[model samples]
Target: MRRYLLCTVLFFTMISCVVNRTVVAKPILFDAEREQLTLEYMRDRYGLETSSSAIDPKMIVLHWTVIPTMEESYKAFYEAKLPNWRPDLENVSGLNVSSQFLIDQDGTIYQLLPETTMARHVIGLNHCAIGVENVGGGEGLPLTRKQLKSNVWLVKYLKEKYDIDYVIGHYEYTNFEGHELWLEKDSAYRTVKTDPGEHFMKKVRKATRKLEFKLVPEK
Candidate 1:
C-alpha cells in the first residue's frame, strides 16, 4: 500500500512541474481564413500537394522577429494574409508568414497558434517544423537571458509532448536540405536570414544540450 501511494505521489509531482510553467495562449488569426492561408502556403511555396492544414511536427525552428514591440510583433503575424511589402516573397508565398509561438523580450511566451500546426516562418522545412519567434533581435536590441530560460523550458515541455526530433535556429534550416525532412520542391527557392543569431542560438543549445535533439544533417 505504501509503494502504491509513493508512485501516485510521484506522478502528481511530474504533472506539477509541467503545469507550473507559464505559457500564455493568446491565439490570434486562427479560423477558416488562417487555415486556408496555411494550406496556400504549403501548396504554393512548398509545392506540397496537401489540401488540408494538418501537420505532424518533427522539429522546432527558432526565429527573432525584428519587429521590436510585442504588440507590433503580434500584429505582424495576426493577419491571415500576407502584406504587399514583401515583393521578393510574392512569387514564393501569397500567405502571410507566422509562427506557432512568440517569446517576448521579458520572457513571456505566447501561443500564437497550435504547436503542431504549420507556421510559415522558416523556408523549406515548414512542412515538418514548428516555429518559435522571439520578439526582438535588431541593431542594439539583443535577445535577453529571460528569453533564453523560457526557450529552454518550452523546448523541454514540447519534447515531452511531441515526437520532436530537432531544435534549430532559422539560419540553420538550410542544413536540413537533402535530408529526409526536406520537402520543398523548388531547390532554387531559398531565403537568407541572420535572425535569432549565432550567439543566441549558442546559449539555447547549451541550455538544451541534454534534450538530444538532432543536429542539422549534412547534404
Candidate 2:
C-alpha cells in the first residue's frame, strides 16, 4: 500500500510538469530613464496608447540588430525619440528603435524592457507581441550558431511561461493579415521587412517542437 501511494504521487507530479501552463518570471525592469523614453517614443512614433491592460502577449517576434554591439543597440533604443537616418522611424523615434529583449552574439539575453510592456519592434503587432533582437547580422558579422542556440532556448522559455500561441520571425509577420493580433495604423504603414531570416526561424521552430510547443503557420 505504501509503495503504491508513493508511485501515484510521483506520477501526478510528472503529469503536472508536462501540462501546458503559463509561468512568468519576474520581469527584469528598465531604468527610469529608459523606461520613460520608451513609453514616450511609442506614443510619439506609433501613436500607441499603452496601459497595464496590454499584458497578454500572444507571440514572440525575432529581429537582428545589424549594429555591432549590444551597447550600441541599447543606446539606439535608449533614446526618447527616433533617429533621422531611418526615415521610416520618423514616427517611431528620433534616437533609435527598441525591442523588449536584446540577445547578444554570444547568446547573452538582455531584457531591455518589461515583458508585459509593448515594444516598437513590429508595426501593427507590437502591442501584443514580444520582440527579441539579436546583436549582429550585417555585411561582415553574420549570425552565429551560438545566437541560434540561444534563440531556441529563449523561445522555449517564453512558450513555457506565456499563453503564447505563435512564434514568428519579423519577416513573416506581414503574412498574418486580418488575424486578431494584427494591428497596423493604415495600409501605407505596411512595409517590407526581412530580419533574422528563414533559415534561422526554421532552426528555432525545430528546437521549439522538441519541447512540444506549436509554431504559428507561415502565412
Candidate 3:
C-alpha cells in the first residue's frame, strides 16, 4: 500500500512540473488598432473574414530574432504598426510582425500574445500557426542549449493544450505553400526565411518524437 501511494505521488509531481513551467506574460501592443489590423490581415491576406483576431492553431512555427538582446526583441514587437525599417513587410500590411511567444537566451519564455491568436511571424501560415520567436540568432549570438530545451518544453506544452499537428522551423513555412493550411492570397508575397535553423528544429523534433507531429510537406 505504501509503494502504491508513493508511485501516485510521483506521478502527480511530474504532472505539476509540466503544468507549472515558468512562462512570463509580457504582452505586446495588441491594442484596438492591432486587433483591427489583425482582422484586416486575415481578411485581405488570407481571404478569411473573421470578426475576431483569434486563430485555430494547427502548427507551431519556431523563429529567431536576428536582434541581439531580449529588450530589443520585445521592443520590435511592441508597436502595432510595422517599423519603417521593415519596408518590405510594411508594403504588404500595416500590422507589425509579432509572435505568440519569445524565449530569451537564458531560456526564459515570454508570452507576447495568446497562443490561440494570429501572429505575423510566418508568411503563409499565420492564420493557423502559432509563432515562437527566440532572441539572438545572429552570427555572434547563436541559440543556446538552454533555449533548445525550453523550446522542446514549450512545444510539448502547446501540443498538449492544442491540436498541433506540425512543429516547423520558420524556414519550412514555404513547404506548406500548396497544402490546405496555406492561406496567403498573393502568390508573389512569399519571402525566403532561415530562422531557428534546421539543427535547432531537428533537436526540438527529436525531443518530442513521442508526440508524433506530422512531417513537413514536400517543397
TM-score of each: 0.87, 0.74, 0.92
Query: C-alpha displacement of 18 in model 3, angstroms?
Result: 4.9
State, as a TM-score between 0 and 1, how close model 2 is to the true structure: 0.74
> lDDT tens digits, residues 1-219, model 3?
999999999999977866788999999988899999999999999999889999999999999999899999999999999998899887789999999999999999999999988889998899999999999995889999989988999999899899999999999888998899998889999888888898888899999999999999997
- In angstroms, the error of model 2 at 171 is 0.4
Off by over 4 Å in 3: 1-19
Q: Model 2, 30-149: lDDT tens per residue?
A: 456545665665565446566332447889999998899977777777654565567865754443467778888876677777777766688777768899988888567788897887
Task: Kindly give the stretch of ten consecutive residues in candidate 2 with the minimal lDDT sum.
Answer: 20-29
Model 1 ranges off by over 4 Å: 1-19
RMSD of each: 5.1, 6.8, 3.2
Highest-TM-score candidate: 3
* Window of ten residues with lowest summed lDDT in model 3: 14-23
Model 3: clashing residue pairs? none
Ranking by lDDT: 3, 1, 2
Error of 1 at 83 (Å): 1.5
Alpha-carbon shift of residue 167 in model 3 (angstroms): 0.4
